[model samples]
Every structure is written in structure tokens, then in C-alpha cells.
Target: MNHDSYPDSYIRGILNTVKTIAMVGASEKENRPSYFAFKYLLERGYTMIPVNPLRAGEQILGRHIYARLSDVPVPIDMVDIFRSSRHALPIVQEALTLNPRPQVIWMQLSIRNDEAAALAEAGGMKVVMNRCPKIEYGRLSSEIAWMGVNTRTISARKAAASGGIQRLSLNRASVPGGATEAAAAAERMERERGSAG
Candidate 1:
């Protein structure tokens, strides 16, 4: 796996598969990027565990914060490193200690450690460097595109509206650009409704 560039399928697969994410270096402040990502993924149905030594034994968004990876009670599907690049190796080493190690180790944007990625990959885990899972999820699911951000890809399929926000799925089966049968049907139905009104 190349660390410089990632295929959309690879990112989408991980995003679709992982259910539980442990965010290392998570912050309590709402203005922090880690907090924002945690909130976004949590709202999208991912179980978010905050790992911050300073805030240990406390709760962030109702989820208990643990001081270290070993402190987490349940199995983690992914370890999202919100810390700096220099701290990645030790964090990856700790993640490798898990009995059933996480399937992925994701370093946040602007945080890349080739040594950490090499170690995690050597442990048979998929490693993503210098990227944000929250951004990837939104991009692959067309959630960010709806927010007026150009994702460099176009799709005619309308997102499933929930709570007045349009959201799409990364189910892998559905093709982009309204190619899926269900998407086509929904497009037609929306057109008819527009005509009727």
C-alpha cells in the first residue's frame, strides 16, 4: 500500500467497515479539530472513544475518556491519532499491543510518520497517513459535496435525507453518478414530484 496516495475504494472500504474508533489525543474543547471529527463520526453512527490522559475518567460527548489505549474496555476497530507526528510511533506501538489489534491506524491531516506507518503495516494493519477519516467519510459518502465543497467528483444520485441533511452511504454496491437502479428510480420519482408540484 502506497503511503503517498490512497485509492477511493481503500478509504471507502475502511470507512464502511469500521464501527468503533479510538481517537488518541482527543481534546475536550469543542473548537478543536479532534473534537469536531469525533462529533462528526459519532453522529454518523460510529462509536467514538476519546483517549486523552489529561481528561481521563471524564466524559466527552457522553463517551468515557481513557488515558491510554490499554485503558479502553472494548475492542477497537480503528485507532485515529490526533497527536503530532513525533508521537505516532509510541501510539502505534501501543495499538499493536491489543489482543485483536485494530484493523486501521489513521494519522490526522498534517501528521505523518513513515516509521509509525511502517510499524503498523508490518503488524498487518492498514495504515493511513496525513489524512482525516472524518473528511474521507464525508467525501466518499457525498456528505461534504452537499455542503458546497467540491469533491472533484460528480454524482447524480441524491442523498437519503435524514433530519433535513442529505446523506449518502458508502455501501460499495451503489455506483456513482446515479448508476444504481435505486438511484435512477429515486431520480425519476423526484422529477415527477417536481412536475406535479
Candidate 2:
């Protein structure tokens, strides 16, 4: 898949519009990235439905875990996947069969299936590949301060020092100031898990 296929505007639009997310493969382990991501989204006031067959009937973050996306009782704005790339297509297929259908199919970092991405896009659903909702929320929503990033401080300082002119760059590295390191580490862990599994 072409990396440029996912334009920033498209992603921003979806992120801004999505209010609820179905977290496929959400785990009970608090240390897992998916767990933290789900928690982060929930804290941000986004309704999160956990979809994990093994954890079905269990509750994580007070939300009951379902065996599959189709089991979700309410409408889902987005489907955030935490499974491997090889397993993504089936989940996308399942999400597509929903009555209202999800508006977006977000494959977490290191998890991307071209066929699945294409299918979702073809169905008028936005597709986000090789990305994490937690990371994106921090980067795009001005919530970097909560993530322990000094973007607000640094940008404010620079603007104050520059006589009220913000010189921040549009580049991802320069905007959130510097989150690539953390994002890269998360991606590495995901890759390791992918390889191990």
C-alpha cells in the first residue's frame, strides 16, 4: 500500500468525527499497549467497547468485552485493531458487516493488511495503518502535555521568547516537538510481539 494513500487531512477528519471505538483484541493486561490505548481513549470521553473472544463476558475499564465486533450492541464510530496484520482482514470483514458500519478501521502500529485497508476504504470507511490511537490523540489533539510531552511548554516558551510568534513546524517531529522516539519504541514492541506470535 502507498504510504501517501493515508493523507493527514483524511486521518484528522476521521479522528475529529469519531466518538466511539470498538477495540478489537483489547487485553486485560494493564501493561499492554492496547490496554493503555483503550484506557487513554476512554479517559478522553470516547466510548470503548472491548472485543476479545477469550475475554468475552469480562469487563475491562468497566466495559464488557465481546467475542467479536458484531456483538457490540451500540453503534461504533471506529474499529481500533490490536491484532497482527495477518489477522486484520478478517476483523475488517466482520466490522464491515455491521448494520451502521464503522466509519474508520484503524490498524495499530506494525499492523497493516493492504487487502483489509482497501476493503475498508472501498466501503467508504476511512483506513489508518501503522498508527495508534493513543499516539495520534496526543499528537493531534493538543493533549501532549498529558502524555508527559513538553510540547505546550516548549512551544509557549518559544513563542514568548520570540515576541509572541510561534515558530513550530508542521513536521511531526517538530510539531509535538518530539514523540517519534516513544512512538518508535511502541512500534518496536509491537513488531517483537508480532514476530514472537
Candidate 3:
């Protein structure tokens, strides 16, 4: 897709479908941008798996860190790449080797790898280069418009929730559905496993 500006639905469809993301290059340091992004995604009900060789075996935000994409135990719906542009291709290549390959490969803001994007797209994975899910979550969910500012309305619980004021579900990252998230994730992974098998 065009890095400059893609369709809103493209972004929405990703955020809606992917429930678990493995964030490569995540930092345990609290002051880093990746740190905040990780926290935000967690708060929004995303199950974030941190992937960094240096921090492997440690915990970030209560989630154990994996040394590489292949080390993650559970299915990762998306691989959020936080490395430099030059590193994206290798990461995407590695991501493609997973049992249930991630649906999306999202390179962080200021990071784009056209070759990686193409490779991933060719492998049937959606690509979002030079973008961050945290930012997209706000724009798509209208959190900037209604999440925080004084709306002064009393019966706006659902509205606030829609704006992502609440944790999990009903945001850009979730689709309307029944059953628990665990069940949904299992079902999704099972379906993909079957297709791959």
C-alpha cells in the first residue's frame, strides 16, 4: 500500500481483525516511545508480546519477552516492527516463517521498507509501513475527538467507550462478536492452521 496515505478501511480492517500483536524492538525502558506504545496497546486490550533478543527471558508489562518472532508460543496476529527501515525486510521475512503467519506487518512511524512490504503482501500478509498502531487506534476510534476532552455528557458511557475510554473490545481493534477473546483467538489460529496444513 502507499505509505503516504492508504484507505481508512485498510487500517480499520487490520485493527479490527488482529487481537494479538508481537512487538519487535520493544523497549523495557519506561521513557521510550515503544514503551508507551506497548502500554497503550495493552490498555486497549491487546495481548502484546515483546520481542527483543537483549530482553529475552525478561518481562515487559507483565508479558514475557521473546528473543525472536519464532520464539513466541502463542499465535501473533500482527508483527509490529519497531526497528529501523533497513531492518524491516529481515523481520518480515522471519515473521512469514511462523506456523500461523501474522496477518499484518506494521512498521513504526518513520520506518518503511517497500521490499519488505511487497514480500509480506506477496505472502498474503497486510503491510502498514511508516505507521504506528497506537496512532491509528486514536484516529480510527476517534479517541482524539472524544476519549479525553470534557464531553460534559452524562449518558455518554457507550460514546466514551467507543472513543476508547474503556479497555478492550468495541474499538478499532475489535469486531462485534460473541464468545470470549480466548475462544476467538483459538478459533482464528485453528482456521489459519488448517489452511496452512
Candidate maximizing TM-score: 1
Model 3 clash pairs?
A: none
lDDT score, candidate 1, position 11? 83
Candidates sorted by lDDT, best first: 1, 3, 2
Q: What stretches of model 2 exceed 4 Å from their correct place?
A: 1-6, 145-197
Better of 2 and 3 by TM-score: 3
The prediction achieving the highest lDDT against the true structure is 1
For model 2, how does the per-residue alpha-carbon lDDT over 16-46 read when each residue is reduced to its tens digit?
A: 6898899999999999999999997787668
For every candidate structure, what is the RMSD over all alpha carbons to the true structure, in angstroms? 11.8, 6.7, 12.0
Q: What is the TM-score of each candidate against the true structure?
A: 0.83, 0.74, 0.76
Instruction: Name the weakest run of 10 consecutive residues (lDDT summed) in model 3.
Output: 150-159
Task: Report how far off residue 196 is in candidate 3 (Å).
Answer: 37
List where candidate 3 sits over 4 angstroms from the true fold. Answer: 146-197
- Between candidates 2 and 3, the one scoring higher on lDDT is 3
1-197: candidate 1 lDDT, tens digit per residue: 88656667788889988999999999989999999999999998999999999999999999999999999999999999998888989999999999789999998877777788899999999998777898888777767877875443455656544453465665523333323566445445543443343
Which digits, one per residue and each the tens of the lDDT, describe model 3 over residues 34-120? Answer: 999999889887899999999999999889999999999999999999888788889999998998989889988767677888999
CA error at residue 43 for candidate 2, angstroms: 0.3
